[model samples]
Target: MTVTSSERTLLDSIDAQEIVSLTTSLIDAGGENPGDTEEATAKVLAEHCRALGFDVRTVEVAPGRPNVFVSIGSAERPGVLFVGHSDVVPAGTGWTTDPFSAVVRDGRIVGRGACDMKGGLAAVVAAMAAVHRAGLADEHPMTLACLVDEEDTGLGIRAFVAESEQRNYTCCVVAEPTDLVTIVGCRGAANIEVEVRGRSAHAGQPRNGANAISAAARIIGIIEGSQAELDANPDPDLGPATWNVGTIAGGTGTSMVADRCVLAVDRRLLPGESAAGVVGDLRSRIESAELTGSGIDVDITISMEMPGFLTSVNHGLVTTAVQSVIDARFIPNGRSAGSTPAPNGRFAGSTPAEFTDIWTASCDGGFVAQQMGIDTVVLGPGEIENQAHRPDESLAVQQLTDSARAYALIATRIAALPGL
Candidate 1:
């Protein structure tokens, strides 16, 4: 589609400086999931939305952690919702630049949260401002939901949905750095701990006691051996389930036989699989291992679980999003604006050459779709490989402006849908 003068004007309304400045400001605020909280960033976002004449509110999802909600439409009508997480993972070591400097150099904004989503958050805010500037808010209703603990526990989104039982949203778009591609679904995540217990004994009398470390090793081997079989049955979009022992700790000293061992397991679940059932299966496997070995005690517990979800490409929200991407081409940067099958052949999207698909990793969008029951899609700037959770995290300058425009176009177009 050709760019219309009015559409060009709307896209031009998105100030690149404003987006960069806001992203920098947010990156400067500490929102590290465990060591820090999003309270400060949430306040900043609330004030920004309020200044634009939108109704905004902040709810504390946890101590020092809050979720900010902004709405431009009446509560009586259905609206579109934008979801962005304000929380970022802890900034581990090794950075060439200051983690929170939000430095802009070489056409990239570098910081801990720049790409893993303060950039996307800035884009959403800029888009909202554009929508307001063009008077699109008056014709269509929409909401922005800024959440906390997306890098860890997802209490913010859980509480947001619980509190919004009376409100209606036609669809949800999560800004999680898809590198300009749309994500229609995502694999779920569940963390489990497998504990092996045995009687401790002196090193001189090793035959007198069972070794927990040996039992744990056996269980690890079993898990590793099952990978091929697990990979054999793949989902149409997300492919196969995966498992990894993220952490393992046990024992006292080399002089004494180990008495206990604990393994922290990270499991990725495909759509249609229940977290409970998956945990149960893992527990059963550990029990079977125990039966075959020395009378070692074995137990499994699910530490956390986030549901996965899938939305068909033919769904209303997806089809509308495809058109919005085409319209976004008005401000072209040489990328195609039509939809096609992704290279992986698992999903479809609006890009000229790439199709939308399910994310291999987990995200809050999965929880939103599974819990809120709203049509959800993940779309934003920054490639996950380029920055997310990595040192010197950054977002391309071009991606920032283009994303704000894309989001503005999406919200405006979705709002015009009949009865939505």
Candidate 2:
């Protein structure tokens, strides 16, 4: 596909400075998850959307946590949607600068959420502004959804899916930090809590009580034994379904035999796996263990689950996104002189190539793909492994500009398709 004059106009209208300013503002707003402080970020996003003359709506998914929606064009038609999260993980100790400072140095913006998603969020909002400014709002429909609680449980996305049941979105682009590579699939995740119970006894008479900690250790061993089997059958793109024992707590004091133990396990799932199925299989395995005869009782529960998604690489959305990334790289204004090359040696202004990969980390895009049945792809600025959730997290300014341009291109191309 070729870039049209109108598309060029839209791309040119996306100012790099504007995107940087917005990103800085968002970073300064400070939405740290587990703190329930996303309202500040939502307000910043909503203000920007209103300033751009888009119809803005804020829906409260939880107390002091809102999802901001910015829309343009007719609601009656199917549209291209941009999804992003507003929350950031807590800024742990060890930062050279204040995590909320949104500092710019060495041509990179530094902050807590700068790379993980605030930068991506700014790019999407800037793209929408450009699309609206270039008179494209009347040409097609576009929506930008800024959600909360992605860093923790997926409360915002779950609420979005429930409320958007009547809307017909043809495709979704989750502006996650993909280092600009098109992501075709991701692993799903679930949090399983196992509680083991037994009778407590004095330390002097430990054998008189069934040891809950010992039973819990046995269960942990059972979980570990399943890993090799999962590793043997890994998904070609998303990798194997794996298990991680995140937390374990048992026993009150050394003076008495432990009566209870709780184990929190994180399980990554493949496309066909469900939380219920995993829990059932685990429960069955544990029940068949020797704990039944030892007066040990076990209870398992699924605290949270996020489904995985796989979009065909050949889909129009994926193809368009790939082309958009290539096109964005070639734009003179979008190239950063000081930008670092990707791990594969690709850099801005280099010979353009099509790159696609899968995310081991999941996102809200899975919800859109599975529940709404919309074709979805993950593409945005910054490196997930190297930058996101790391101290002094930062994103290159060039990436911010390129991502905005690419998003605008995607919005126009996908909206102008024949059937939609």
Over 5-107, each residue of candidate 2 has an lDDT whose tens digit, in order, gives 7777888888999999999999999999889999999999898888878999999998999999889877888888999999999999889999998999999
Candidate 1 local lDDT, 1-420, one digit each (tens): 455677678888888999999899999886888864788888888877788788898888878888888888668767778899888888899999889878999999999899989999999888888887788775666788899888886778778877845458888899889886777888898998889898799989988888898888988888886677788888867788888999999999998989999999988888778768977776677677653356578888887788888888777677666556545643354455344334234344333224465688778887778877788988888889757989999998778887888787787777656645
Best by TM-score: 2
Off by over 4 Å in 2: 164-166, 331-354, 416-420
lDDT of each: 0.80, 0.86
Where model 1 places Cα greater than 4 Å from the true spot, the runs are 1-5, 164-166, 290-295, 329-353, 415-420
Clashing pairs in 2: none
Q: Lowest lDDT 10-mer window, candidate 1?
A: 343-352
Model 2's TM-score against the true structure:
0.93
* Residue 243 in model 2: lDDT: 98
In angstroms, give how far residue 288 of model 2 lies from its true place. Answer: 1.7
The CA lDDT at 152 in model 2 is 94
* Backbone atom clashes (below 3 Å) for every candidate: 3, 0
RMSD of each predicted structure: 3.2, 3.2
